[model samples]
Target: MPSSNDSRVERARIVASFGRQFYVRTLDAPGPDRVAVTRGKRTDFCVGDEVTIRLIGADQAVIERGLSRRSELIRSDRYNVKRLAANVDQAAIVIASDPRFSEELLLRMLLACATAEIPALILANKSDLATAWAAIAPRLQVYRDLGYPVIELAARDHPQETRAALSRYLTGHNTILLGESGMGKSTLVNTLVPGAALATREISAALCAGRHTTTFSKWFDLPSETAPSGAIVDSPGFQTFGLAHVSDSQRVHAMPEYTELIGGCRFHNCSHIQEPGCAIRAALESGAIDPIRYLLFSRLAGRD
Candidate 1:
């Protein structure tokens, strides 16, 4: 049994940085002032640790530890094991309406979250544009049909309204901003966190996207009177959030609708593509499955 004080300080913490001299993590201790600082040793810590700590005098100390993470958002970048975020209860996958939205990649990311068994919400940004709203509306509808919550928002304008809609998911859970170059992930994070003025950049014509503003993964604290739930982390601009490490089963399981169709795929080893009796192929042809998503799914399932 845990003590009353022990349970009182059980709010989750996020690993900030592990340096040669010290370790740092983000915590909402002493309520949602978002100023609780957790520090320990390098060997004793790694970035993205969801830990428990107690307030001593001036600093926070690690006390009883929580269970290690059941899953994480990890990917290989240049042969380095880059940890995206830890203890992600959900991911607010951001897609911009500015340069046009690609539902293909969006579905790919949602599938990745499903592969990891994490819930995901799709945030369609740049809704201020008239042309974009029309295109984004259908894309948003498509994801909603797939049973994922979708929101069309413009961060630079209506920050408060967007904040309220997203606040419920961020409480006590780490959320990663998964988006392309120009979708304003960094800007949004800076706004969410009080004093953080993270770097920002504009879309480039040469690449037809926003320039990479964030260089690496960093943690931020959120302001809330209760347990802090508005926290967010900003990651570097990634053109391709590759899913090579995930299994084929994860790719299929990520799509809620595919559960009924996976077993129906032909040959038991059906590639779900070009296989004559593949259920996925038939569904795509009959307009039952979104062709864009099916195409991305086949690629990740190694059928491409």
Candidate 2:
């Protein structure tokens, strides 16, 4: 709650937002005591959004306007698109062993992050599961060779290591934590930020998927001493992440591995499916490009 004399407009960043209410950290006081604010009927806000708010009453305020957003990460399905986070500098894509792992989803997520122009770091959780780790190691290496950083972490077994590694990646950046349910995203969040006690649930044996634990996106500032200022936003787990907003051209350019060969394709507008003299296929056959990634690209381009 605000003091009786707190009626004024101020700049703030949205730390947590859901429905009509938002938890905003004031520019002057960036800490735990965020003012709870509501939006006007037409006002829209997302986690990491910078906005101006006017305090109208004690502990309450209304968002007056949203500042410009540098970038917006969105997930879409056939039905609709939803904004996951805004103004994030990097994306932390978390994958785990429980409930099984999907390479297709991983590729899609990386592509989405690439298209959004946000660098992504792959956090392979549950490395303590030896059998699962062994099976996923080769695929993980493919991503690593493509120049994306891959950090192996056993969140439960090595909390300190996980926190330290994550802190290094998040330093000086606003990173969004992305993953499917049951992948230990919440658990990682709890480890990274001790004070953030996000709820966690076990994977369902029958369904082979994790139950939804997070219902909304929330941001937490990281503890800083020698490192640059950093923060992370934990988003709710989802079964699917769509890239309907990304164009075919953007998708092709997003993959750094394919960049060198893109210009050599047969057609200037090569779909890369059945086109003759396609350089992408040539590279895949010659072992220059990873076959699995090519397949994933084909699927995304509707060529599969």
C-alpha lDDT of residue 125 in model 2: 91
Clashing pairs in 1: 170-229, 171-229
Residue-pair clashes per candidate, as listed?
2, 2
What is the per-residue lDDT of model 1 for residues 93-158, given as tens digits with 9 covering 90 to 100?
Answer: 888888875666676677678767778888877788888678667767777998888877778787
* Poorest lDDT segment (10 consecutive residues) of candidate 1: 198-207
TM-score for candidate 2: 0.89
* Predicted structure 1, TM vs. truth: 0.74
56-151, model 2: which lDDT tens digit per residue? 664566778889999988877666778889999899899987666787888888888998889999999999888978888898898899999999
Using all chains and alpha carbons, the TM-scores for the candidates as numbered come to 0.74, 0.89
Candidate 2, residue 47: the lDDT equals: 89
Q: Report how far residue 58 has shifted in candidate 2, in Å.
A: 3.5
* Model 1: CA > 4 A from native: 1-23, 26-47, 50-67, 77-80, 198-212, 225-230, 301-304
Candidate 1 lDDT (Cα, 0 to 1): 0.64
Query: In model 2, which runs have C-alpha deviations exceeding 4 angstroms?
Result: 1-4, 30-39, 198-212, 225-228, 302-304
**What C-alpha RMSD separates each model from the true structure?**
7.4, 4.6
